[model samples]
Target: MSFLLGHFNYLIVVFLMMGGLWITFSSRNYIKRMIGLALFQTSVGLFYISLGKVAGGTAAIVLDKTSKAGEALNAHLSPDYVARAGVDGVVYSNPLPHVLILTAIVVGVATLAVGLAIAVRVREAYGTVEAGEIAELDRTEAGPRA
Candidate 1:
């Protein structure tokens, strides 16, 4: 279908996001979980960038205007000129998503750093990084679970 062909990137993004989620959920190693989390974050960034992109578009930037002889005297008429001059009749990609994703990337990296630090502390304390083994140890410490 034309729709599917036109939006193939979206499908890829979905697949990537799903794969990352699967990895995060199925893996028992804390390091592997962090890697999966990073993959998920990357996929999210890709999705945002794709959403911001246009098939045939330019960057969104307004142009400056110079006043003509008659327009100089009639300053009130400048609004019309300003509006027309600002538009270049070119389709442009949305920039808000890109900006938002940039911030998300920064936050994601900070979160990853903190997560890794926690994992390291967990390793030092438990002598193992596997989540299953950690859980068993915890269960033993607290006695049998109901």
Candidate 2:
């Protein structure tokens, strides 16, 4: 029960990845192919973001104004407070994954842009942008048989 819910995002990420891959590989339409690429790329971004999240931890940025110079890190919690606290108090999402996701997001955007540009070119060259049409045209251009 708890385990299933904990790993739910992984399932979503897997589904998204497969769906995107299928769209990218199986489609014939130029725009459709680009759409699939976008989905696939976004799923990657989702994967990274999912990894970076910490349950109750604060954001990763350091304080510029509030901290006194060279203040030692220390804290004391009463027994009741310690006993009542869930894992949230100790859990911190990995900052590295979040940073990686940020880069991946930028890469995804670039990929989407390139894919769209290619699709436009394909449409201009083929007259019809449908996948089957493009393949048929390509086949016909290659040669004809009786």
Candidate 3:
């Protein structure tokens, strides 16, 4: 249907989110879980980027009033459009989502690095990266503590 076609990006986002969550929950390997977490983060970023887009919109850049291009733009715009926009008829896309996503990407990478480092340490300490194995090792080490 038209509705489904129109919202294809959202469908992809949802799919990625569910797949990531499934992988994160179902996997026993620390590295696999980290990958799933990264996938989920990427889907979130993509969703934000999709939300920030506007139909027939350009970048939200202000043109110099004195420039020829600005003058031409103003001349081509209708009075009502100029009145509404306070300048020209150009529709600008919101940049806030993109900026926030950039920040999230940096934080995600740092978090992934820390997670991988911890996994490496766990592997060295427990001789395995599987959650079940690690837990078993811990329980055996504890020796049925009261």
Candidate 4:
């Protein structure tokens, strides 16, 4: 259908999100879970970036009217058109979502790094990265808690 074709990026985002969640929950290895979490974060970033996009739109940069480029842009339009359309008849994509996503990406990378470091420490202490094995070791070390 046209609707499905038009929103293909959304479909991919949903697929990535579900797959990442499944990998994170179904895998017992800490490394696999971290990778899944990263994937999910990436999907979220992509979704926000997509949401900020506009068809036939330019970047939200302000051009000085006295600049050559701005003069050239204005030359293509009539005063009436400029008054009717605003901003020299140029359509700009929203930058807020993109900016927020950029921050989210940086935070995501830091969180992932911290998570991986913790996993590394867990591996060093337990000699294995499997969650079940770590739990078993903990239970054995407890030695029948009353």
Pairwise lDDT winner, candidates 2 and 3: 3
Q: In candidate 4, which residue ranges exceed 4 Å CA deviation?
A: 63-86, 142-146
lDDT of 1 by residue, 20-108 (tens): 99999999999899999899989989998888885444456532224353334234444554444334433346879888988999999
Which is superior by TM-score, 2 or 4? 4
Report clash pairs, candidate 4. Answer: none
Model 2, position 31, has a per-residue lDDT of 82
Total clashes in model 4, counting residue pairs 3 or more apart in sequence or in different chains: 0
The C-alpha local distance difference test score for the whole of candidate 4 amounts to 0.81
For model 3, what is the alpha-carbon lDDT of residue 65? 45
Worst 10 residues of 4 by lDDT: 82-91
Model 3 misplacement above 4 A: 63-87, 142-146
lDDT of 2 at 2: 95
- The lDDT values for all models are 0.76, 0.68, 0.81, 0.81
Instruction: Give Cα distance to truth, residue 139, candidate 1, Å.
Output: 2.9
Q: Is candidate 1 or candidate 3 better by TM-score?
A: 3
Q: In candidate 2, what are the lDDT values of residues 1-146, reduced to their tens digit?
A: 99998899989999999999999899877788888878887888888778777544435654332244212211333434423532333323467977877788788788788878877777677777787877787888642221
Q: Write the per-residue lDDT of candidate 4 for residues 1-146, one digit (tens) a residue.
A: 98987799999999999999999999999999999999998998888888888654557797665678666766766666655554656645678988998899899999999999998888878888899988998888642232
Q: What TM-score, to 2 decimals, does candidate 4 have?
A: 0.78
Decide which is better by lDDT, 1 or 4: 4
Candidate 2 Cα errors over 4 Å, as ranges: 63-92, 141-146
